[model samples]
Target chain A: MTMYNQTTDERVDKALANSFLRQATRRATDRLRNNKYKASAELGNWEEWRAAGEAIRKNVISNLDYYLNQLIEQMEKRGVHVHLAKTPADAVTVVRNIVSEHNAKNVLKSKSMISEEIHLNHALEEDGIDVVETDLGEYIIQIAGEPPSHIIVPAMHKTRQQVADLFEPIAGHALSSDTPTLTRFVRTQMREKFLRGDIGITGCNFAVASTGSIVMVTNEGNGRMVSTLPRVQITLMGMERIVPSFRELDILLNLLARSATGQRFSSYTTILTPPKNTADPDGPEEYHLVILDHNRSEILGDKLFRSSLNCIRCGACFNVCPVYRQLGGHAYGSVYSGPIGSVITPLLEKDWKKWGHLPYFSSLCGACSEACPVRIPLHDLLVKLRMRKTQSGHTPQVERQIFKAYRYFFTREKTLRRALRLGAHLQRPFVRNQRITGGPPPLSNWTNSRTLPMVAPKPFMQLWADLKNKR
Target chain B: MSNTSDFISNLAAKLGRPTPTQPPPQVKLSVPQYQLSSSAERVSVFLQNWQALGGKGAIVRSEDETLQCLKQWFGEQPITWFKENSKALLAWDKLPTIAESAFSSLNWPLTRYSQSAFDPRDRYSIAASAELGITGSDWGISLSGTVVVKSDPLRGRAISLLPPRHLSFIESTKIQDNLFNVLEEVAALGSPPAAIEMISGPSRTSDIEMDLSIGVHGPIEVYVIVIDH
Candidate 1:
């Protein structure tokens, strides 16, 4: 399956139970969380930094149209080609045209969610062009032929042994499960692709409107290698990913690294201005920036949800999300998954039938909102999306009927009290030793993995009324 | 290719929002000011603290001492020395005569540089990658023992990133009382040229199966040269 699309909840449940995935995800996330804590503590004024980051993002998104125009003007002035794609299809077509024009047979890609959003890899491969993912996590998923399971740690679901098994036949070496050995093998294998690839594609972490430059932050120098080694460099950025100036980038970078992985800084933050002058020998001769609106421009002007565009893709929401912790990213069935995904996917894809159920996946705990670096009120947005979905008639008929019956019973107090008393008595067979271990057909899904709490013998309100009468 | 206006119109239609006639509003929030502690002991405390944060540092009295330290730290190993073509570096005593074969300048564009310089197989023991990776520190944050490297052509974002070992030279006077102080300094500099990166230690990640891997994506080794002169 492509990286953007995901399997259903049942498939995700099976994946999450896999002892290997649970161990790896838990370990990696724990360490990342700890390091982030320490790093932020060290910074001393992390809250101020976060506030500054949020303010800067809020400013840019508010004036996105103007900055985008300014960015286009600057890029064009520098002789860098800029393309604006309104849809994922439009984005794919633009990239395909560039690849076809360059006769690109092998395309080396840096990790870009925009490319994933457009399914550019599948598009390129369909045209018989070999698209190789060079990021270590992306590389692992590409080989397994699965979409990324997490935003920051794409291959968070895979074990090292699994990676070793996948690479052994390809490398013709007895690669070990040891981190160093496996990483070393991938490095050797990817180096050849970097040197010979026809095009280098990357995602823009932030685009500087003032200079027409795209900023990419990475720990691996692959971003640098990919953007620099190839004859052509193409960057795909969401339209809302613009910042007015570099000074603003400083604040964002502090928050981005700290919130995403809890590092003082990513090892490398590369900013490529239009190709260097003729006197310079080391950059792509052809530079292209694809500004994708896919659905971001709409999110920008939205009153309740425009703040969603302020996301830096730090994956902080996913890391802290309780539902994501249980179901993993695959269940969300979108390139952007977890709290951010629930809000964004529906907005991006107008087809609510496919994505409408996603917003309900959250428990409305507000943990995602707290974890968000740019301070996007992700939980509120998820609830709003759910409301929108219902208003748009995307709710299933069965669910609507169930809620309708509940609404009728709950509006009248006498009916509600009688129903509760009857529910306690009727649930006796299903309830054993104070908890419902097994239930009727409709409630079976709840009891399948979770036990339902035993209903009290008497309603609390009724008990309170009896006590008052005795007094 | 579709015209730019068509793309913008299509985007507006998809988002179901009114087409913005002008740009969105720019909100200018007052950035908080950061003041450095004016204590004589703060500098030494900062240095000691920085060392505790996995950073290596030393005080050199003269050029001779600098060369001696270099020899002691890395001797006879094939090394890539990145020194500026500046007069100060040129005037160093007992400077090693790096043959044309030994050194490569950062003159190559980023792509060519990666191919020629990076060898995962250990073909080269060291790469004196650039003449120098000059960075004007956005003030060193004493509280965290971190230094911010704002991106510029002279700093060459890659200098701090690509090498297996990174050496950054900063003046002694630039170290500040805390991270907030640095933010104020950055704000005062107005808009930085392009990018500003706060580097604490060597490139590190615990990503692969929770194993702490140094240099997974950036330099494995990091050195900070604090020049008192």
Candidate 2:
């Protein structure tokens, strides 16, 4: 009954049938891609920026232990409490304990993928604590009782009318299906929560080691409010999210903002070294950073997959991914989605039997790798994941057999020609207007969604031979 | 209170190395240097980029012109929420003396964090209730059109964050070519401040069907007045 319980096939079928979802995703993704292109072009020297970003991330990840220790020392020195979580349950336990200690009745959260990864909201709600999602996109999906459909734009699947429908009941009046009116309602609603909420939770975009600062890049300013208003603040960080210093942050942030939202900077990029000074009038009285290491070390152990951790979660890959353009994020059936998601989900989650199929979600077009600001070779990794899945004997029997037959016939020219001739004859009954619309079980899967081109009447090799004779 | 030893040591083990005691020597990469010749160029770039981000800005010769500019700008505003008279504006104590004097000379309302008579213990309630906030910025990044505001004893973080509109004074000399230069200056200081907010423009989001909406949680309108010292 939970969010990710559906099988991959079921989710893909459901997503494919939703026309509104398709339209919304296409419009949003197209605009995001165009904006990012313009912004990066305006910045000029984008490739050099990407190279510098890659270098910085590569350095921190290679020497992760050193930088993490440095970050911990600096944070503690600034009077911020730090906790380590070895598992998802451990992370949830730490957050739950923090809430219980404060006797907090209401909790406010900004957009954090790590919180979703650990299912922190459900854990708190189970204890009868009210958890409010403060980001506009996150708030929309939160009320709809759904998981985020996109990484940055969480409610990308919902239209303006859908959002208005969700808020009208809560507002106790009729509402207009307009962006300004809907946004104003949420602003009025969240302002009260920001003032009175007992504890605030946010994800760290980049943790600077030398200064012990947790950076949050947000357009909506919810991140600022979350860190500033609550008496206590909790930051959830995946362990690999670190930079050596602010010098490196400058480089990565240049790439991040342009790649994520195509802005020079998000409206508010706040660097907080928390547990404020005693003389300061605003900010958290107690600050806690929970560093979670849920299967990231295992990813770090594999040299091929180590670079995946270098992702800044900008969601640029999602915009350019061809597979994601059609299927959207929900079909991936996980917290992370798109190319980055496909590469990391199976490696991070324990249920390989379910998550193993995620790697096959890509068309291997290499657009994700091209779009990556930190330069993760996502398509190459997807191919590698497919190899790993096959090595583990997790691929479907039909697919394995199909590949086996393909390998057998493709090795010899004569046999391939004979097979092609056989296919041409066999496809005749199914072909309608030069397209194969229906076939047996395995072929039916392909034909059900889209048409397969009928085999050539005369094989190309034979036609080439005849042309050579005529010349 | 869980220790990081196990967590960090496991990562060290995975990397086939012992836990490091010191930070690694970083490979120096060349950053893109956005070179501008003069302070005038920097201020002009800042103003241009600031307006592109939907912020209003003006360059003034002195603090006296800044006061005059504020008076004229407020007078021209279509919104009446900030001008209704009693304690509607909050300003940082670190702002130049002209700000305090402008309140009396222009008969405008202003309150500081500590001096708020509303609630002594929770004086930030004044920040929460105020319609407008005015403060002095530490630095302005001309390349990104960002104003850096660092919180201190006299400057409350809420003053820049809690209000519906924010107005900040940035000395033209404080404008820099890029964020890297500002970070370098911050690093030169021994200890960083509690919080450093780099405000690029008014709070904004395009979440509702990708329609851009201003001021979701923070200030809807932000004005940057660059003073020539």
Candidate 3:
């Protein structure tokens, strides 16, 4: 399957050319980062909390099977229907079957990255089910017929004027380019969907293994609307999204809220044990939890990449990533983006040669790793991915040839010194003021943006030899 | 439905181990704790935090003060709006007798929410139509200014959710220092209720250009009357 619509450079070029997207991403990320900094600092021991969060996630992932089993048992015990989906297609089919069995027409969805991963909306829409995205950002993107650009703020790339344009046609008239005006319009639109939606599809933030409950941390309260209003509630959960109990949840929730949106807590943290009690007034009557593997087990097996599963989907790393700051999520051309996305996309796709170039999306700066609340060593993982790509012989032929020549030359000091001596003379034509201003194909690619310092007049080894003689 | 056993077993194989029958011992990790020395500190911190989250309310020493607070809130609204509108208040049926009497005395159209009062669908629409929702919070976390509400057979979740404005009473004694303490209290119960929500503030979103918009899908305004008595 062609997951990325554009080539990597093409995508980056397109994102870079869009000045509005650049400004929007920078503004949104800066605000989010500032908020996160304040929120984490308010706790007085942010590192301790992050460490505790990392430990909890590490423990849960290490014993994922046990927790999955316990969660399934508890959910079933609570009269919730549990389905295991091994692939994206399997998950789509499960949701489709549930929709058909209930003969449901309208499906209201909250913001869920997994749902995007599984391509739930397109599949359901093809089946002629009216699926509505309830989260304001999701709703905006849904109407715009676009994929989410950011995890938390899906419409981060959209300006208020752009949003006004998107809502104008829906409202059957022009609307103002003000946040409140736009928000009120969508609120009216979504309330009808919430009340009339037959099935509520939500993404599980954390599935409590001990209690058989799904936790939703949302600011818009759409999560609550989806879970509580619809008759049939279906939660799409990645197999790794599990906490041992509510106790672990306390730590993770604190970390997630502070990291994701820089709030002491999200507006609503709903811990719902589904299939409301027999006498309960208004929660969903039928509850279904889809436990999806979708190559997560493959990731879990590779010790190097296993920690990526510990991500709470907080998107904190994205804010701190310099590459992401330059090129918004869309530039990555994956449902997941930023440093974490660079590390995992190839692993999840299992075609390093095809998706392997994603690791280059990073600058090797460890800001992502430092910003990560769960302490996923994202920068290290990206480097390892690059290494894996080379080991698997996925490097470009020209690049490989250069490396091969270097390996041969370095092995013979005489040949290396001879080649370097010749190169310094050959570069004279392109050299200007001790910098290479222009060169041929491979060299020009680097020189086009920034001049490269002429290969030092004397190689480092030669300089060392002269210094040794002077000593 | 696909069998979970095969799925889990396959995962176990990837981990280079069999699916163990027993769960590993859980490590005991200490959660970060916050403490306020006195109830006064708790109430002040909670009110301060709540206001910071765009919530408006005050601490009242007596039930009469709580009534006066609610009455003054209505007084701020133009009387004509209530007259032309439903003038309805959606409330949890089991509110403290004082709040219940206060609601009756307001002489406004009131919807007391209970499972048996209306069908499932009707409860949502009714709550959605009401101008305000009033309920009692089980606990309040002081640091975050969060109100913990439980949904059971007797109470509908929509009481605090569907309405645009929500006012809930939280007893000062029930205020906890932080979310950790409130969570510990919930876990101490045999099991979680059908649904429990830790609502920190009014529904808000910053999706469009990172502009803050309140009450996108839930209550736009939330108030908590912390009764110190």
Candidate 4:
């Protein structure tokens, strides 16, 4: 699989060049956006529901330790083994230890962002364990050896024809772009893997503190198969993913479905408690929950940024983001992408230089904040990250000098007017039809794709002054 | 650490958040009431909505009709059947024809005690690889076309989820007007049972390449038998 921790620029360039990826993303996002509109409108009191969901998430995060302890106690009572990991390494070690004890060779995974966060698939594959992602989107991306471009729709960037072409060689059959034919082929191929899998790995959506149940909402049945058929089941969850009770769960579910797919509810909402009794025929014999802190605890402690942990991974912010609309999730380079990713990735990783550019990718339109179901101030967080970056002296020297000059010019109206007049005269060489078509190295990147309006001939302030004098 | 009060106090102090003053107000939970025009009309409206959501439903008047429906459905598809150990099911004597391995007579009270007893996937297919699951629903919501089943020792959650096709036998008397009405009824039962599942239709998703795939996560085909006994 492609490493998302690096190669943000390369992926973004590739995604931009691939016409099919851009078209498919636009089409799918449009449909999802429409569905969300219809579903949320139908529900009535959607804002109220969003508020309740936000409040519940905020409350849970503030008292996360208490909830975690309560969840562990309740889960243990239900015969589930719970392990808490302070970091990604700790989480991997805990999972590796379990796999070693079980001697598991084959593992089936449901789509989980946390697993993606720690690069669990590579870790398992390195150990010679065959880990198969059972969700169709994850499966397609898994086979192609790429990280998910979109959280909800992992392979949204790929077209059906591309998927057919990809699967044809692997399945040793002529595959078609037809939906039913492709699905049937995948179902047949995955059936064997499901039945034979020694361990089922999944991501936890919400860990119910009251019942100690791991709540998973899926549109596909692979989660059920993975959880049931395998003797051992492992769930990796971010520490912040907890809800107080099922009652609160109802409110969140309503908001999540509407925000994610515009459905009243997902096709399947599975809550698996421990295998109830030996006499009970189905469910995993052993259930293991790996709760990974992996930077969330620190995020939880930060008063200004603590609200970021309240994100439910719905990808609603990504959908409505103007910058994300032009450039997909791959551009963000982190496992968590889009506006939330900008806030999350830098905080999660120690390598600041690699992920530091991510926060600046946004235009800070506040669309992400408006779209955020949990009411996270994503745009504000982006600005804060920029401030932090600047304060830490991470900004490039040339850019810093340019911005310092801009500050001086903007502070004085005379200097600003003179600078604007000088810029208009200097643009004479590049101006074509009153638009700057070419410029110096850095400015060329902006002018090549888009026309830079010629410093607005006469400046708005000058025009207003002329109008006042004429009156 | 050994003392429960000390554990609570220390834990509360560590988080630096105030402990609840009086044990967090007993969550004031209430199920909103929705009124329907009439029972018969409600059932019709429910059936329409169910059919609109791509689900199939049929009304059976008697036990004989129920058996006939089951036999016809099984005759069409490869299936293995398991019967609940309830007196009502036993009176029908539907067990003799199926192979001993195919049909097991479960203990009724024990099955009822455990929420997962009726789970359909537990029994290996008796006649053929089981593709269709058969069960009796505890209640039905006509407005939402939802079937509400309480998980008990006798009833398995898998019975509803595992198979590609699910056939539920629910009574007409149990059909409620709306989801709210069903929630109210459930609340009246006191301290909601261990599990209460509201299944609408076959499991589905449009996640894979944005193509709608039925039975992706849950049963693809769900059939509801509304019996008037």
TM, chain A, every candidate: 0.94, 0.94, 0.98, 0.92
| TM-score head-to-head 1 vs 4, winner | 4
The single-chain TM-score for chain B of candidate 1 is 0.58
Per-residue lDDT of candidate 2, residues B27-102 (tens digit):
6888667879999999999999999989999998765776788878787442365556355778776576656666
Residues A156-205, candidate 4: write the lDDT tens digits: 87778888998899799798788777887877687667767888999988
What lDDT would each prediction earn against the true structure?
A: 0.69, 0.88, 0.87, 0.71
Instruction: State the lDDT of candidate 2 residue by residue for A240-321, as single tens digits.
Output: 9998888888888888898998888889999888888877777888999999989998999999889999999999999999
**Error in Å for residue A348 of model 3:** 1.3
RMSD versus native structure for model 3: 1.8
Q: What tens-digit string does per-residue lDDT give for candidate 3 at A213-285?
A: 8999899999999999999999999999999987788889989999999998999999998889878888988
**Docking level for model 1:** incorrect
Q: What docking tier does model 3 reach? A: medium
Q: Which prediction has the highest TM-score against the true structure?
A: 3
Error of 2 at B128 (Å): 2.0
- Report the C-alpha displacement of residue A149, candidate 2, in angstroms: 1.3
Q: lDDT (0-100) at residue B199 of candidate 2? A: 97
TM-score, cand. 2: 0.95
Tens digit of per-residue lDDT, candidate 1, span A294-380: 767667656788888889998888877777777667767777888898889888887797888789879999988887767788999
Against the hidden reference, what TM-scores do the models get? 0.83, 0.95, 0.97, 0.84
What's the TM for model 1? 0.83
The candidate 3 chain B region of ten consecutive residues with least summed lDDT is B78-87
TM-score of chain A of 4: 0.92
